[model samples]
Target chain A: MSLNPLHEIHTRRFSRNLGLGLTLGAFIAIIFGLTIVKVSRGDYEPPRAPTATEATQ
Target chain B: MSDVSINSPEFTGQGFEGEAQFGDFFALLKPRVMTLVVFTAAVGLLAAPVPVHPFVAFCAILFIAVGGGASGALNMWWDADIDAVMKRTARRPIPAGKVTGDEALAFGLTLSAFSVVFLGLASNWFAAGLLAFTIFFYVVIYTMWLKRWTPQNIVIGGAAGAFPPMIGWAVATGGISVESVLMFCLTFMWTPPHFWALALFIRKDYDHAGVPMLTVTHGRRSARNHILVYTLLLAVLAIATAFTSVGGPVYLVVALVLNALFVKGAYDIWRRDEDVSETDNFSVEKKFFKLSLLYLFAHFGAILIEAVLTRMGMGGWT
Candidate 1:
């Protein structure tokens, strides 16, 4: 008996898979871009170290 | 007998029918409605006094569009029953059997949560909260409660569609102001007359679907009178907006011309009886409906131009 590797369901659902893949990829790109913008804008900066004068005070 | 034959009773018993494609899922988002969302939101963002980074602005609009699309999915999910009955909506994804109601519900809820969270992270919580409220209002308040119960459904439900610009403004300004309120008012006021004109042309769809549209409950002449009255009120609000911070000389001119045409259209709709409308195949009503679309786009476009010119130091009277 010969074995077939491809299934008909795969062909029928290819477009849906591709679309979901593209949508997820785009979401990742948006997140990366947003992270860069927020970081560059100091939105996620750690709190600054206290100065000795301030610490003494 | 071939096991792969789709026509076989065995294959039919396996229950693979009307399998949705990528386009079907996208249709669940109501892309046509998203265009209005994207446009109005962009206008609100740009028309604000503060400047946003281009990429950030892009993110804000994208998330707002997603939020709007999420609401559309929810609307389709909830209204699948009515949609199946109405000629205008019978072909929607859920009603047409391409996408199941459960699938639509899951899709809508997921996108709603994602959009609200991402919008809060991308811009501000105020805008995100507004978007969240908008989804709730559209899905719950309007779709679930108001739509089937009252003839004033469109009047109140219009608020859902009117919110994008306000969300856009809040994204930029991080708060609401008179400017954002005015923009919201502009869309809010324009919606009733716009929809009533459509109801005039497709009254039977609502009648058959058992939806309490103004035309269904109040009657055609009453709907016409409502259209005229709303158009007059909308014209006053629209023209008054020309003096606000978002408006300029260009907007004033556009508003003047468009309002005149809109009022004329409404008047024409009001003057005609059903006999005349039927004779002309509702051509005047159809023309009015088309003009309503142009009226909105032109108004927002003019505001966008004013914003651009203001940035260039050539915009408003100031």
Candidate 2:
């Protein structure tokens, strides 16, 4: 069979695909996981009050 | 196939030559796709419960748009050969010789690097990281790997296009949520039906280009069946989104009416014979294709309206 460069690149090993899938799955999981953790730990603090310097000005 | 040197720029006179025009640069961005990315990302941003500063939100959207454009440029650079052979893509900047492949590659790489770095600095690292992955997915994974080889290209490649809203949501909240995941799912599920409708009508183009699109590889009848199935799936997902925190009565009403029309249009396309389908002036396929665009825009628009109303304390399921 003649080696087509483009086809070679296209049909390269499945290892890369597996790796990428796992990485994306992990990335999404971590982000959502962090959000859940943050929300659940929340003692809902409002935005900080302006400094005294701003009040004097 | 013979190996060609990549050091020298490939220039064909059939496309643009001499100097690149303003429009040539703009065309490299794939503006039509960019519009959808921007709109969906904006919806994601607005729909988030956290209120981002207006200026920060604008900047985030701008960078997201740039990241999307960068991905398009790189994709065009890599796919120029097949693009030159395809009728639908032959007039693109690189293929047309308005811009050299190397020039497109360089432009794309520079923009990709800049967009990711700046987006990271401007927003949280999480958003920046997602933006980088999105660019990598489009260029290295979808455009480079799956597109020419598999008939499932669009199905797998849809994830790259679906990331923008999630990235937008991350920009606001510095993280992802079930809401953001649902938004991502909305775009991901909609893509197969939208593109397959065009594939049905343009199977000749794919055949000529030697790209293994579903319509070309599986035949038109099977492709039509797949489109109908995906459209049905998309209709269900779209209506379900209306019950989430970001959705409300207005969105539910819109989703019900639009989905009914969309499903009916898909059914019309599914039932027609290809020969008879081609002969009609207002073909069901063409109508379905056009309606698919509106279907997505309406869903996103309803989300935006719901978000705005909820912010004003006058809407949402409280």
Candidate 3:
């Protein structure tokens, strides 16, 4: 039988714990960065004012 | 000589040990939680100042729901061990043996990757990024770390659950706004009280599972105090949200009434002793638990109604 020591170690050390942490951290950073860039574009164009169709009873 | 031994037939199954029903796959997605996510995301999309194409809006919400479901599957896979020990959770698909842990892990990872990639392709990167973060936060930060480590788990972990509405808003506008943050804050503040009330009643289950819920680690009295404190904060946040772009006369009325009832319920739970609670005819804990669910749904429902009214130009911020 062939044994895969590296696979076992990778699963124990990386796949189970630290990998999730690192991935989550990176994901949050990306969101924050994208939000900052979007906000900084100086494009504050709010949608057109509510129309009469919107105001109808 | 007349005695005959009975032989049992050997069982051969294609996959895992237990049978995986169609329902099991659905359960893995945590349908109840997915419903809440979908509703909130819909409200966010509708309430946004910017207009999105109807078809695009629908696609965004679909992706958000898929992301939420993927997070749930990952959560179940990771918490299978603890779930097996808790009576309330023991019957969940993974812990109940209807699905193998490896199968669940693979399912979750595949969905997570697919949902993020597809959402990014379908919507703007901003919304996709939020969805991805939400999934990661729920699976990695909340489920794996905070849940088992501290009584403050729900307080911080609540952020993950609160992101759906913000993501929805981003879908429409391609950006974040103060209004969306307030919506997120509403759910974030509400979570501690909601979950702590359940903890008060299920301390034994958490204790047996060694999960370190506030009630188990800090004592029931402390948990009750925490619940009241967070509930008060939640009431303040909920009512204050009424003044934002999303708020109006209708939502204000709903928020005021709901907050009053919610605060009273929290106070009642805080005042009762465990011994008294056991002997009392009315289980305050149980009442509080049921009310908490209603409280969240009512708040979100009110938000949706306000959005509809605003869209119809009948009421809302001009």
Per-residue lDDT of model 1, residues B98-148, tens digit only: 899999999999999999999999999999999999999999999999999
Listed models, DockQ each? 0.37, 0.02, 0.02
Candidate 2, residue B198: lDDT: 84
Is model 3 an incorrect, acceptable, medium or high docking prediction? Answer: incorrect
Please give the lDDT score at residue B310 for candidate 3. Answer: 80
Q: For candidate 3, write residues B52-167 as lDDT tens digits.
A: 76656776787798889989999999999999999999999988888889888888888888777867765688889899999999999999999999889999999999999999
TM-score per prediction, in order, is 0.94, 0.80, 0.80
Residue-by-residue lDDT tens digits, candidate 1, A1-57: 221334444454777999999999999999999999999999999999999999999
Candidate 2 residue lDDT tens string, B85-196:
8899999988777788888889789888877876776668899999999999999889999998899999989999999989999999999998899889888988888888
Q: lDDT per residue, candidate 3, A6-30, as tens digits?
A: 5342334344366557756865665
Residue ranges of candidate 3 with Cα displaced over 4 Å: A1-57, B1-17
- Clash-forming residue pairs, model 2: B15-B96, B16-B96, B16-B97, B16-B98
In DockQ, how does model 2 score against the reference complex?
0.02
lDDT of 2 at B134: 97
lDDT by candidate, in order shown: 0.92, 0.83, 0.82
